[model samples]
Target: LQQVQPQGEDVISGNVSLPKVNVRGVVSNLLRQRETKQGPERVGQTDSDVINLVSMLFDFILDDDNLPVPVKALLGRLQIPYLKLAIQDYSFFSRGGHPARKLLNELARAGIGLNEDADHLKKDMVFKKIQSTAQRILTEYEKEAVLFDELLHDFSQFMQTEVRRSQMIEQRTKAAEEGKAKAQLAEKTALETVRQRLDGKTVPEVVVRLLTDGWMGVLKLVFLKYGPESNNWLGAVKTIDHLLLSVAPTEDDAARKKLFNIVPILLKNLRQGLNSVSFNPF
Candidate 1:
């Protein structure tokens, strides 16, 4: 392995070097600038002026081209710890030559030196006021959160209820459609029997008996199942009314009267057969 050295003019070229005249020129220029700005008669300056002059010198050294080589080498070899110690020493000298006592005195004037109740009352009152204001704001916010939560909960419940209602309506509609389908099937069976009889084809005796008696039997079933209340009995009464309309004599009195007579007598005989459970002759 080989080590590569820096070859740039800024780092390796000896011609780009620091010189003694640059240091002297920078220091002298800083001193003259300070005197011109702050007045000529001030000789033994304060600690703040000394610090300013030192900072100005640091900037000038950084900018000068002909700085001293020894100074540049020393700055390059400086460690962070050594630089920090130098800064602390400078700061100690700046703070009235005694940083600890100056800091303590400032803290003391700011109420650190007070005994017992000397400052407690005012401090406690201010702290308590701040606490009370914070508590009031928290309570108001909590109440608002609770109100918002309640509103959200109510809306959720209302939506659920609407969903349930819609489902129930759908179920009822499906049940009604199924019931209509059953009734249509029963009507078709009855019509087929009637068609067979009119066409002079032999119908099973059981089917004829059922068609004649089943309408009255349905009326009786309705009455027995729902007779406890007047509203419940309304369906039975309606069935009886429709039965009378279907069998009643009409404007073709002669023909309709003959039909009414034949159907009623057939119904009387079928009623007896339907009353007997063991009379199935199909």
Candidate 2:
């Protein structure tokens, strides 16, 4: 079998243009040349209809905009082979489950969403696979139809693995986005809590800086780990209130005694909170 070289064509603005020629005449000439060597065979009305239908199918495949230009070109190489198949087997038209028909469908589907401007066309896995498949059929196929089934099975497995990998990447991206949103909310809640407590209260510059910068981070961390209603969150908030009261000017004897009593515990709690966030007290 002489390898049918792909006809010349040009692609412009995502459309392909082939030299004007009669498709039926081309098919007839190809069959005539083959018959010359293999002995003359009568061309009947059914063979003519099959040739015309295969030509139309090729025309549709070429004109399809969804397929990339390179993909369309690769598929065009199969025209002569497909024409021969359809003429020999009438079931190529009637049987939708034909291996050759399914292989064609899989090739087109695989090429969908591939960018036309991709660099190094030969390096692309899908394009390479399609190119290899078309070349194998062109050079190796004679009367064996099982070749189509073998190619289809291998291609389907590759595509299935690719689909699973893409799904996993997509899921990880979604999870990262959700985690970012949750952290942002937690930070906002932490800021508002600190601001409300310090509002209308005269506190030392050191205390103000500590709560806004270091303690606020601790609150955000606690909120993220144990939620707003957790005992850990309530205890952290209470520590902030006690720290403020300890800094206030108190002349009452009872109040001063109480402040002194709680001062050691307040310092201990503050040290632990700051350490949780890796904040240095010094």
Candidate 3:
């Protein structure tokens, strides 16, 4: 086909316009993509397709190409919402796994704004900036509503997964702790019963000697009292105190004499009570 050049300032002005070939080509491709369904055939889409159909249009409006390299670079930073939307759409429709991630990453790199120094700054500034930008977008660009909705849907899905994972991890950790606690309590109760049976003999003293006293004994007593129905908080406190007293800095001689006297009396009383027991004989 023959092309007619649009009349403008004379060619002598040394200015000429290109055929707009790239722009027109891109627009046609965009229309075609809209009509196409997700399938193996569409997997061959190129980087230029994404850039031309989306990023280039935004660039054309913003006159971004005329900006300094650093400024243009800043403008091209990734918008997470947009990238996530594109990723989710491609993943769901096209079943493009690694390719989708790569394409999304490239598009994100090309058209997103940045959060420079966000780590160093206070949160209020960041929050206010986001709110102001969103408000501006709402007022200025009603046509972009579909894009915003898609982005929000992607975010909602992400948050739902995040919440579920956190709940699952919390539940598993709680269950593990409860299991450990139950096992410890059972062991303590068994030990306490053995101590009670040998109370009048040297066995209780031997076990108490083995314990280092302080928090360990406190924990033991707490388990004994709170772990079983027969146990009470008061009993826990008394047990802790008794174990502590045995290891306290009091005069050693006085303490030993008291313990010795108490043990013998307890033993004698227990033996006499046993002797007085009546048995039925035929």
Candidate 4:
């Protein structure tokens, strides 16, 4: 067997000739773009800007580049409602900590495996539980009245696998790096590895997470669009926390306390006036 070396910016593989590549130029251009567009635009408080932001968020979710085919199809039934939810509060989707994007990205990234699991997973009891619960949440949202604790209870149950994954990551990190500094670096790498590898090994976990997270994203976008003036979703969410606190003397459910861990659920409706502009007119 004969091995061929690079021949003056060209490579020979049998009859095939590989072209020379400019790696540095590719990377430099990417960096330049990132420097210019690393964050969401600084949207103004103007009525128009609010409307524009809401419209943009709606488009972002449905655009071809934003979602993969299978995942999009799976949630297609809810897209219109989801967009309606977002326009009500665009601020929430813009932030992190919501599990919806993670679930969407995971399912989208799963490729053919997700489509294969669809029928089987939906048939699972856990999947049915999630579907029923999510539908209930949507109904409440439409009525403009949401039970904060109920949502969290469903969320906690659905996130059990994710919680276990977190614990596994922590245990693995602590096992390898007993020291603080090394532990941080190791945990970071481990998390990236875990996220990249995650997929629906079980039908129930996948369906539940997908429905829960998708709705969570929709619910969040509602606040981002409509609750900008309140400027404190946590404060709104804390009303529930305060109520639970008042009842803690007899409630006795320790897990209910975690409802305080939620981001605020603003009661304010989406701002009106579609003619308004969110971007700078000048």
Candidate 5:
């Protein structure tokens, strides 16, 4: 700190000097990030200080009584898993390809009236992602009461399983195209031959493999946590039902047929999960 005794004019205003510290590696990483328009090459699932800082700001905003009613209502339903992921997985938020990041950008655009900082804030990639998620929660599901975290939890698990399965199928097909058809068929036949004499770790691996598509994967998302023991099975079940039923039969033929084939499996899984609390019912 650089300081001097108060002069006559300063004495009247009670002026004082304070030390200033520059933020570079810790936070100004973002300022440089904006200037360069590129995020760091690698990212992981943890950034304690950034996560804590964002959390503190969220709490501060949420607790501010002076905020308008709509702002409060918007923040209330904005809880989602990826909000934290956006902080933890820096590339996902900053590299400009993620939908979650787009959601944040949307929020930046929404902040025009309440604070003057909003105008400048929209340019920061990280800030935009955080804000856009809050905005989407408010606008997208205004008619319903939903916790964004729970929604992400239910959806991400199912989507991850499906996406992973599709990736595996594509890999297998590519291998076969590269002249590995015999190997692929052999592997499948070997697994089939051992169907009755399954090993300990085999069931889970196979379950994951089989649950790669619409029929089984959808079942897991719907009733796995929607049992009677769950806190809000009704709401979770309702959300799943709405998502599934909204797709019209004429719109997508393949999806419609898949949805139809899924109903029976979904019912069986639902009965096993919610009723018996057993992972196996079929």
Candidate 6:
């Protein structure tokens, strides 16, 4: 019994390699030991079939490359316990929703994304929880089937909470990325508009700086808040056009009068736009 008892700590800690023990042989030996104690008639054909099936199931689990190494090792430690359960309750094979079977499935699912590196394993909460559950089973499990039910309930709750937290983080990250992209696009649109308006125009360096820097930011803000088709965006664009018209040379008296009218409104709009983006207009 001592020799066949699972050495889970060694496997989990990576202190030693997983011993190459024969699953069928181990099951047979344990069964023989039990038979000696409970009378020779206890071992039978049904028990032999159970042993073979349990061994095959374990073989498949151990050989699966998809499962993380730590997960496989921990599950391997449960061979004796699972074999006992299968032999005790033949319904374990027939029932799809069996507590023991569900527990194993949940454990495997949780381990799918787990990092197998030793340093990461130490910090992995899921792996720690699985290790705790396996340790509890190894130490406390006997003939009680309710143990699996309780463990499954607790593990499922933990997993659900973790999944929700992960979803919230993912959503926030995606929103931030989307916002950054929209802001970049808006800035590009604003710069293009400023360049098109200023092309071949002889304006003072201060006015050029205002349009290229502060006014461009205002346009981006307007586009972001009200969109390109909105009245607010159109108003901002008109302000830029008026500023350019006011600054251009005009000799006609009527045109000079129009320029005088445009100057005050242009200055007012420029003040408001600069103020909106917190641009200093000294």
* Candidate rank order under TM-score: 6, 2, 4, 3, 1, 5
C-alpha local distance difference test of each model: 0.39, 0.80, 0.40, 0.38, 0.42, 0.82
List where candidate 1 sits over 4 angstroms from the true fold: 1-143, 201-269, 272-282
Q: In model 6, where do residues sit more than 4 Å from their true spots?
A: 1-37, 117-119
| Model 5 TM-score (2 dp) | 0.21
Q: Per-residue alpha-carbon lDDT of model 2 for 47-79, expressed as tens digits?
A: 888877887887887788998887887787778
Candidate with the larger lDDT of 1 and 2: 2
TM-scores, all models, native as reference: 0.25, 0.78, 0.26, 0.28, 0.21, 0.85
Off by over 4 Å in 3: 1-142, 203-282
lDDT of 4 by residue, 166-261 (tens): 689899898766556544543453344233333323234543343233322332332444442454433423332343333333454564554344
lDDT of 4: 0.38
- Best by the lDDT measure: 6
Give the per-residue lDDT of model 3 (tens digit) for 28-125.
44446655764323323553354334454335423544332322222223222223234234432244444323333333333234332333222323
3 or 5, greater by lDDT: 5
The candidate scoring highest on TM-score is 6
Greater TM-score among 2 and 3 belongs to 2
Give the per-residue lDDT digits (tens) of candidate 5, residues 78-188. 433333344535665356445544443334333323432433434533333334444455446432333444444444454466558769999988876854554454345
* Candidate 6 steric clashes: 0
